[model samples]
Target: MTAVVRHVMVRGRVQGVGYRAWVDHEARAKNLEGWVRNLRDGSVEAVFAGAEDVVTAMITACRRGPSLARVDAVQEEAGNPDALNLRRAGERFSVLPTV
Candidate 1:
Protein backbone atom coordinates (compact mmCIF):
# COMPACT_ATOMS: atom_id res chain seq x y z
CA MET A 1 0.00 0.00 0.00
CA THR A 2 1.29 3.48 -0.82
CA ALA A 3 1.90 5.77 2.06
CA VAL A 4 0.08 9.07 2.42
CA VAL A 5 0.69 12.22 4.36
CA ARG A 6 -1.51 15.17 5.21
CA HIS A 7 -1.59 18.43 7.08
CA VAL A 8 -4.88 18.93 8.84
CA MET A 9 -6.12 22.18 10.31
CA VAL A 10 -9.13 21.96 12.60
CA ARG A 11 -10.92 25.19 13.34
CA GLY A 12 -13.54 26.37 15.82
CA ARG A 13 -13.58 25.84 19.55
CA VAL A 14 -10.56 23.60 19.11
CA GLN A 15 -7.98 25.27 21.26
CA GLY A 16 -7.78 24.40 24.94
CA VAL A 17 -10.37 21.78 24.22
CA GLY A 18 -8.34 18.59 24.58
CA TYR A 19 -8.24 18.21 20.83
CA ARG A 20 -4.50 17.68 20.75
CA ALA A 21 -4.63 15.01 23.39
CA TRP A 22 -7.47 13.31 21.61
CA VAL A 23 -5.57 13.48 18.34
CA ASP A 24 -2.57 11.89 19.96
CA HIS A 25 -4.68 9.13 21.34
CA GLU A 26 -6.45 8.46 18.09
CA ALA A 27 -3.26 8.63 16.05
CA ARG A 28 -1.65 6.09 18.30
CA ALA A 29 -4.65 3.83 18.15
CA LYS A 30 -4.60 3.94 14.39
CA ASN A 31 -0.85 3.40 14.29
CA LEU A 32 -0.44 6.63 12.36
CA GLU A 33 2.73 8.65 12.23
CA GLY A 34 2.61 12.38 12.82
CA TRP A 35 2.19 15.18 15.30
CA VAL A 36 -0.55 17.46 16.59
CA ARG A 37 -0.19 20.95 17.92
CA ASN A 38 -2.18 24.04 18.79
CA LEU A 39 -1.91 27.14 16.63
CA ARG A 40 -2.03 30.80 17.56
CA ASP A 41 -5.21 31.22 15.57
CA GLY A 42 -7.16 29.08 17.98
CA SER A 43 -7.00 26.14 15.66
CA VAL A 44 -5.55 22.66 15.95
CA GLU A 45 -3.08 21.49 13.33
CA ALA A 46 -1.79 17.98 12.74
CA VAL A 47 0.34 16.02 10.33
CA PHE A 48 -0.57 12.38 9.84
CA ALA A 49 1.18 9.78 7.73
CA GLY A 50 0.66 6.10 6.92
CA ALA A 51 -1.19 3.90 4.51
CA GLU A 52 -3.61 5.92 2.40
CA ASP A 53 -6.62 4.43 4.11
CA VAL A 54 -5.21 4.98 7.57
CA VAL A 55 -4.43 8.61 6.90
CA THR A 56 -7.86 9.18 5.50
CA ALA A 57 -9.43 7.52 8.50
CA MET A 58 -7.50 9.91 10.70
CA ILE A 59 -8.94 12.75 8.66
CA THR A 60 -12.41 11.42 9.20
CA ALA A 61 -11.82 11.19 12.92
CA CYS A 62 -10.67 14.78 12.94
CA ARG A 63 -14.09 15.72 11.74
CA ARG A 64 -15.71 14.79 15.03
CA GLY A 65 -12.63 15.47 17.15
CA PRO A 66 -12.84 15.00 20.92
CA SER A 67 -15.82 15.28 23.17
CA LEU A 68 -14.88 18.72 24.42
CA ALA A 69 -13.77 19.93 21.03
CA ARG A 70 -16.26 21.53 18.68
CA VAL A 71 -14.76 21.21 15.25
CA ASP A 72 -16.18 23.80 12.90
CA ALA A 73 -13.87 23.16 9.97
CA VAL A 74 -11.17 20.70 9.10
CA GLN A 75 -8.74 21.69 6.40
CA GLU A 76 -6.73 18.81 5.07
CA GLU A 77 -3.92 19.11 2.56
CA ALA A 78 -1.68 16.53 1.02
CA GLY A 79 1.73 16.61 2.64
CA ASN A 80 5.10 15.31 1.59
CA PRO A 81 5.88 12.02 3.23
CA ASP A 82 9.52 12.96 3.30
CA ALA A 83 8.68 15.88 5.56
CA LEU A 84 8.18 13.43 8.40
CA ASN A 85 10.81 10.92 7.35
CA LEU A 86 13.56 12.39 9.46
CA ARG A 87 11.47 12.77 12.59
CA ARG A 88 9.79 9.39 12.56
CA ALA A 89 11.92 6.36 13.11
CA GLY A 90 10.28 3.11 14.09
CA GLU A 91 7.49 5.13 15.57
CA ARG A 92 3.86 4.32 15.20
CA PHE A 93 2.64 7.75 16.29
CA SER A 94 3.49 10.59 18.61
CA VAL A 95 2.04 13.76 20.05
CA LEU A 96 4.33 16.67 19.37
CA PRO A 97 4.98 19.34 21.90
CA THR A 98 2.60 22.25 21.54
CA VAL A 99 3.92 24.81 19.10
Candidate 2:
Protein backbone atom coordinates (compact mmCIF):
# COMPACT_ATOMS: atom_id res chain seq x y z
CA MET A 1 0.00 0.00 0.00
CA THR A 2 1.21 3.50 -0.74
CA ALA A 3 1.60 6.05 2.03
CA VAL A 4 -0.32 9.30 2.04
CA VAL A 5 0.15 12.57 3.84
CA ARG A 6 -2.27 15.24 5.03
CA HIS A 7 -1.90 18.70 6.49
CA VAL A 8 -4.54 19.45 9.11
CA MET A 9 -5.55 22.58 10.92
CA VAL A 10 -7.68 22.28 14.05
CA ARG A 11 -9.32 25.30 15.51
CA GLY A 12 -11.08 26.31 18.73
CA ARG A 13 -10.09 25.73 22.34
CA VAL A 14 -7.07 23.71 21.29
CA GLN A 15 -4.35 25.67 23.01
CA GLY A 16 -3.24 25.24 26.63
CA VAL A 17 -5.00 21.92 26.79
CA GLY A 18 -2.33 19.32 26.05
CA TYR A 19 -3.80 18.92 22.59
CA ARG A 20 -0.40 18.52 20.96
CA ALA A 21 0.58 15.79 23.39
CA TRP A 22 -2.69 13.99 22.76
CA VAL A 23 -2.12 14.21 19.04
CA ASP A 24 1.40 12.83 19.40
CA HIS A 25 0.10 9.84 21.32
CA GLU A 26 -2.71 9.17 18.88
CA ALA A 27 -0.44 9.44 15.83
CA ARG A 28 2.11 7.10 17.31
CA ALA A 29 -0.56 4.57 18.20
CA LYS A 30 -1.55 4.54 14.55
CA ASN A 31 2.10 4.13 13.54
CA LEU A 32 2.04 7.42 11.74
CA GLU A 33 5.03 9.60 10.93
CA GLY A 34 4.54 13.32 11.14
CA TRP A 35 4.55 16.35 13.46
CA VAL A 36 2.03 18.55 15.23
CA ARG A 37 2.38 22.11 16.49
CA ASN A 38 0.47 25.07 17.83
CA LEU A 39 -0.22 28.05 15.65
CA ARG A 40 -0.34 31.68 16.80
CA ASP A 41 -3.83 31.96 15.45
CA GLY A 42 -5.11 29.83 18.29
CA SER A 43 -5.22 26.63 16.33
CA VAL A 44 -3.44 23.30 16.24
CA GLU A 45 -1.70 22.21 13.08
CA ALA A 46 -0.65 18.69 12.29
CA VAL A 47 0.60 16.41 9.56
CA PHE A 48 -0.08 12.70 9.30
CA ALA A 49 1.82 10.35 7.02
CA GLY A 50 0.90 6.71 6.85
CA ALA A 51 -1.38 4.32 5.03
CA GLU A 52 -4.39 6.08 3.54
CA ASP A 53 -6.93 4.55 5.91
CA VAL A 54 -4.91 5.28 9.01
CA VAL A 55 -4.22 8.83 7.93
CA THR A 56 -7.93 9.38 7.39
CA ALA A 57 -8.66 7.92 10.78
CA MET A 58 -6.18 10.31 12.33
CA ILE A 59 -8.03 13.20 10.75
CA THR A 60 -11.27 11.94 12.29
CA ALA A 61 -9.58 11.68 15.66
CA CYS A 62 -8.47 15.29 15.40
CA ARG A 63 -12.08 16.36 15.25
CA ARG A 64 -12.59 15.34 18.85
CA GLY A 65 -9.10 15.92 20.26
CA PRO A 66 -8.45 15.63 24.03
CA SER A 67 -11.09 15.86 26.72
CA LEU A 68 -10.02 19.36 27.51
CA ALA A 69 -10.18 20.54 23.95
CA ARG A 70 -13.31 21.97 22.38
CA VAL A 71 -12.63 21.25 18.75
CA ASP A 72 -14.55 23.57 16.49
CA ALA A 73 -13.21 22.69 13.11
CA VAL A 74 -10.76 20.45 11.34
CA GLN A 75 -9.43 21.36 7.94
CA GLU A 76 -7.31 18.97 5.94
CA GLU A 77 -5.45 19.02 2.67
CA ALA A 78 -3.34 16.54 0.77
CA GLY A 79 0.37 17.07 1.20
CA ASN A 80 3.80 15.61 0.70
CA PRO A 81 5.48 13.80 3.54
CA ASP A 82 8.03 16.59 3.84
CA ALA A 83 5.65 19.45 3.31
CA LEU A 84 5.92 20.78 6.86
CA ASN A 85 9.71 20.46 6.82
CA LEU A 86 9.70 19.65 10.51
CA ARG A 87 10.17 15.91 10.70
CA ARG A 88 13.46 14.32 9.71
CA ALA A 89 13.62 11.32 7.40
CA GLY A 90 12.64 8.08 9.19
CA GLU A 91 11.72 10.00 12.31
CA ARG A 92 8.69 9.10 14.40
CA PHE A 93 5.81 11.39 15.15
CA SER A 94 6.46 14.38 17.47
CA VAL A 95 5.25 17.63 18.88
CA LEU A 96 6.98 20.64 17.41
CA PRO A 97 7.32 24.19 18.66
CA THR A 98 4.62 26.70 17.86
CA VAL A 99 4.81 28.37 14.47
Candidate 3:
Protein backbone atom coordinates (compact mmCIF):
# COMPACT_ATOMS: atom_id res chain seq x y z
CA MET A 1 0.00 0.00 0.00
CA THR A 2 1.17 3.49 -0.74
CA ALA A 3 1.60 5.65 2.35
CA VAL A 4 0.34 9.21 2.10
CA VAL A 5 -0.38 12.26 4.21
CA ARG A 6 -2.83 15.11 3.84
CA HIS A 7 -3.48 18.38 5.56
CA VAL A 8 -7.07 19.53 5.64
CA MET A 9 -8.77 22.67 6.81
CA VAL A 10 -12.47 22.51 7.57
CA ARG A 11 -14.58 25.61 7.69
CA GLY A 12 -18.08 26.73 8.65
CA ARG A 13 -19.32 26.34 12.19
CA VAL A 14 -16.68 23.79 13.06
CA GLN A 15 -15.69 25.13 16.45
CA GLY A 16 -17.42 24.22 19.71
CA VAL A 17 -19.35 21.56 17.87
CA GLY A 18 -17.31 18.45 18.71
CA TYR A 19 -15.60 18.51 15.32
CA ARG A 20 -12.19 17.83 16.83
CA ALA A 21 -13.42 14.98 18.95
CA TRP A 22 -15.40 13.58 16.06
CA VAL A 23 -12.28 13.71 13.89
CA ASP A 24 -10.25 12.02 16.59
CA HIS A 25 -12.71 9.14 16.76
CA GLU A 26 -13.00 8.78 13.01
CA ALA A 27 -9.26 8.87 12.38
CA ARG A 28 -8.44 6.35 15.09
CA ALA A 29 -11.15 4.02 13.83
CA LYS A 30 -9.39 4.05 10.47
CA ASN A 31 -6.04 3.32 12.13
CA LEU A 32 -4.58 6.62 10.92
CA GLU A 33 -1.82 8.62 12.56
CA GLY A 34 -2.10 12.40 12.89
CA TRP A 35 -3.79 15.19 14.82
CA VAL A 36 -6.72 17.59 14.67
CA ARG A 37 -7.15 20.98 16.29
CA ASN A 38 -9.14 24.19 16.24
CA LEU A 39 -7.62 27.19 14.53
CA ARG A 40 -7.97 30.74 15.87
CA ASP A 41 -10.04 31.62 12.82
CA GLY A 42 -12.80 29.16 13.71
CA SER A 43 -11.75 26.56 11.17
CA VAL A 44 -10.62 23.09 12.16
CA GLU A 45 -7.28 21.89 10.85
CA ALA A 46 -6.04 18.33 10.67
CA VAL A 47 -3.30 16.09 9.39
CA PHE A 48 -4.00 12.49 8.40
CA ALA A 49 -1.28 9.97 7.66
CA GLY A 50 -1.70 6.35 6.62
CA ALA A 51 -2.42 4.28 3.58
CA GLU A 52 -3.51 6.51 0.71
CA ASP A 53 -6.98 5.00 0.54
CA VAL A 54 -7.63 5.25 4.26
CA VAL A 55 -6.46 8.84 4.37
CA THR A 56 -8.69 9.66 1.44
CA ALA A 57 -11.65 8.09 3.18
CA MET A 58 -10.95 10.07 6.31
CA ILE A 59 -11.07 13.31 4.33
CA THR A 60 -14.37 12.34 2.80
CA ALA A 61 -15.72 11.69 6.28
CA CYS A 62 -14.57 15.13 7.35
CA ARG A 63 -16.77 16.71 4.70
CA ARG A 64 -19.75 15.44 6.69
CA GLY A 65 -18.20 15.67 10.16
CA PRO A 66 -20.52 15.02 13.15
CA SER A 67 -24.24 15.61 12.67
CA LEU A 68 -23.83 19.01 14.30
CA ALA A 69 -21.11 20.43 12.07
CA ARG A 70 -21.99 22.74 9.20
CA VAL A 71 -18.87 21.86 7.18
CA ASP A 72 -19.28 24.49 4.47
CA ALA A 73 -15.94 23.83 2.80
CA VAL A 74 -13.02 21.47 3.02
CA GLN A 75 -9.62 22.57 1.71
CA GLU A 76 -6.96 20.00 1.21
CA GLU A 77 -3.29 19.80 0.27
CA ALA A 78 -0.45 17.35 0.37
CA GLY A 79 1.09 16.91 3.79
CA ASN A 80 4.40 15.78 5.18
CA PRO A 81 4.60 13.23 7.98
CA ASP A 82 7.52 15.11 9.43
CA ALA A 83 5.16 17.99 10.18
CA LEU A 84 2.49 15.94 11.99
CA ASN A 85 2.85 17.67 15.37
CA LEU A 86 1.69 14.69 17.40
CA ARG A 87 1.13 15.26 21.11
CA ARG A 88 3.32 12.38 22.29
CA ALA A 89 6.03 10.07 21.09
CA GLY A 90 3.92 7.12 20.06
CA GLU A 91 0.41 8.49 19.75
CA ARG A 92 -1.60 7.17 16.84
CA PHE A 93 -4.01 10.08 16.77
CA SER A 94 -4.62 13.18 18.86
CA VAL A 95 -6.96 16.10 19.41
CA LEU A 96 -4.57 18.96 19.90
CA PRO A 97 -4.99 22.27 21.68
CA THR A 98 -6.32 25.19 19.70
CA VAL A 99 -3.82 27.34 17.83
Candidate 4:
Protein backbone atom coordinates (compact mmCIF):
# COMPACT_ATOMS: atom_id res chain seq x y z
CA MET A 1 0.00 0.00 0.00
CA THR A 2 1.21 3.50 -0.74
CA ALA A 3 1.91 5.47 2.36
CA VAL A 4 0.56 8.88 3.24
CA VAL A 5 3.07 11.65 3.73
CA ARG A 6 2.26 14.94 5.38
CA HIS A 7 3.96 17.88 7.02
CA VAL A 8 2.34 18.39 10.42
CA MET A 9 2.46 21.60 12.39
CA VAL A 10 1.21 21.37 15.98
CA ARG A 11 0.52 24.41 18.07
CA GLY A 12 -0.20 25.24 21.71
CA ARG A 13 1.93 24.22 24.66
CA VAL A 14 3.94 22.04 22.38
CA GLN A 15 7.47 23.08 23.19
CA GLY A 16 9.69 22.40 26.16
CA VAL A 17 7.18 19.81 27.25
CA GLY A 18 8.64 16.63 25.83
CA TYR A 19 6.23 16.76 22.91
CA ARG A 20 9.03 16.10 20.45
CA ALA A 21 10.18 13.11 22.39
CA TRP A 22 6.66 11.72 22.54
CA VAL A 23 6.37 12.16 18.79
CA ASP A 24 9.56 10.22 18.19
CA HIS A 25 8.31 7.39 20.31
CA GLU A 26 4.87 7.37 18.72
CA ALA A 27 6.23 7.47 15.17
CA ARG A 28 8.68 4.68 15.78
CA ALA A 29 6.10 2.52 17.48
CA LYS A 30 3.78 3.01 14.52
CA ASN A 31 6.66 2.36 12.11
CA LEU A 32 6.22 5.75 10.51
CA GLU A 33 9.13 7.41 8.76
CA GLY A 34 9.50 11.06 9.63
CA TRP A 35 11.41 13.84 11.31
CA VAL A 36 10.15 16.16 14.04
CA ARG A 37 11.46 19.43 15.39
CA ASN A 38 10.54 22.53 17.34
CA LEU A 39 9.80 25.65 15.32
CA ARG A 40 10.69 29.20 16.28
CA ASP A 41 7.03 30.09 16.13
CA GLY A 42 6.26 28.02 19.21
CA SER A 43 4.81 25.22 17.13
CA VAL A 44 6.16 21.76 16.47
CA GLU A 45 6.56 20.59 12.89
CA ALA A 46 6.95 17.02 11.72
CA VAL A 47 6.66 14.87 8.65
CA PHE A 48 4.83 11.57 8.83
CA ALA A 49 5.09 9.05 6.03
CA GLY A 50 3.51 5.68 6.57
CA ALA A 51 0.55 3.43 5.97
CA GLU A 52 -2.71 5.38 6.04
CA ASP A 53 -3.90 3.79 9.24
CA VAL A 54 -0.58 4.31 10.97
CA VAL A 55 -0.33 7.90 9.86
CA THR A 56 -3.82 8.60 11.11
CA ALA A 57 -3.03 6.99 14.41
CA MET A 58 0.04 9.16 14.75
CA ILE A 59 -2.00 12.25 14.01
CA THR A 60 -4.55 11.24 16.62
CA ALA A 61 -1.80 10.76 19.14
CA CYS A 62 -0.42 14.17 18.33
CA ARG A 63 -3.72 15.70 19.28
CA ARG A 64 -3.10 14.59 22.83
CA GLY A 65 0.59 14.91 23.29
CA PRO A 66 2.56 14.05 26.40
CA SER A 67 1.20 15.10 29.75
CA LEU A 68 3.18 18.28 29.63
CA ALA A 69 1.74 19.28 26.30
CA ARG A 70 -1.60 21.00 25.80
CA VAL A 71 -2.08 20.61 22.09
CA ASP A 72 -4.52 23.15 20.64
CA ALA A 73 -4.24 22.46 16.96
CA VAL A 74 -2.72 20.08 14.45
CA GLN A 75 -2.00 21.31 10.95
CA GLU A 76 -1.14 18.83 8.23
CA GLU A 77 0.00 19.36 4.65
CA ALA A 78 1.09 17.26 1.73
CA GLY A 79 4.87 17.24 1.85
CA ASN A 80 8.05 15.38 2.77
CA PRO A 81 9.89 14.25 5.82
CA ASP A 82 13.00 16.36 6.57
CA ALA A 83 15.37 13.45 6.90
CA LEU A 84 18.69 12.95 5.19
CA ASN A 85 17.65 9.43 4.21
CA LEU A 86 13.94 9.05 3.67
CA ARG A 87 14.15 5.37 2.79
CA ARG A 88 16.18 4.40 5.80
CA ALA A 89 13.88 5.30 8.70
CA GLY A 90 14.05 2.04 10.62
CA GLU A 91 17.43 2.71 12.18
CA ARG A 92 16.59 5.82 14.20
CA PHE A 93 14.04 8.59 14.02
CA SER A 94 15.87 11.68 15.11
CA VAL A 95 14.55 14.45 17.31
CA LEU A 96 16.30 17.37 15.69
CA PRO A 97 17.58 20.29 17.68
CA THR A 98 15.32 23.31 17.87
CA VAL A 99 15.17 25.30 14.63
Most accurate candidate by TM-score? 3
Q: Write the per-residue lDDT of candidate 1 for residues 25-99, one digit (tens) a residue.
A: 989888888877777878887889889998998899899988888889999999877657544567656555556
**Model 1 segments more than 4 A misplaced:** 85-92
Q: Sorted by lDDT, highest first, which candidate order results? A: 3, 2, 4, 1
Q: What TM-score would you give candidate 1 relative to the actual structure?
A: 0.86
Residue-level error in angstroms, candidate 1, position 76: 0.8
**lDDT (Cα, tens digit) per residue for candidate 2, span 1-99:** 689989999999999999999999999999998999999999999989989999998999899999999999999999776664687656788788888
RMSD of 4: 2.6
Identify the leading candidate in terms of lDDT: 3
Clashes of each: 0, 0, 0, 0
Please, what is the whole-model Cα lDDT of each candidate in the order they appear? 0.82, 0.90, 0.92, 0.83
User: What is candidate 4's TM-score against the reference?
Assistant: 0.85
Clashing pairs in 1: none
lDDT of 4: 0.83
Which wins on TM-score, candidate 1 or candidate 3?
A: 3
Error of 3 at 11 (Å): 0.3
Poorest 10 consecutive residues by lDDT, candidate 2? 81-90
Candidate 3: tens digits of C-alpha lDDT, residues 19-95? 99999999999999999999999999999999999999999999999998999999999998786766566798988
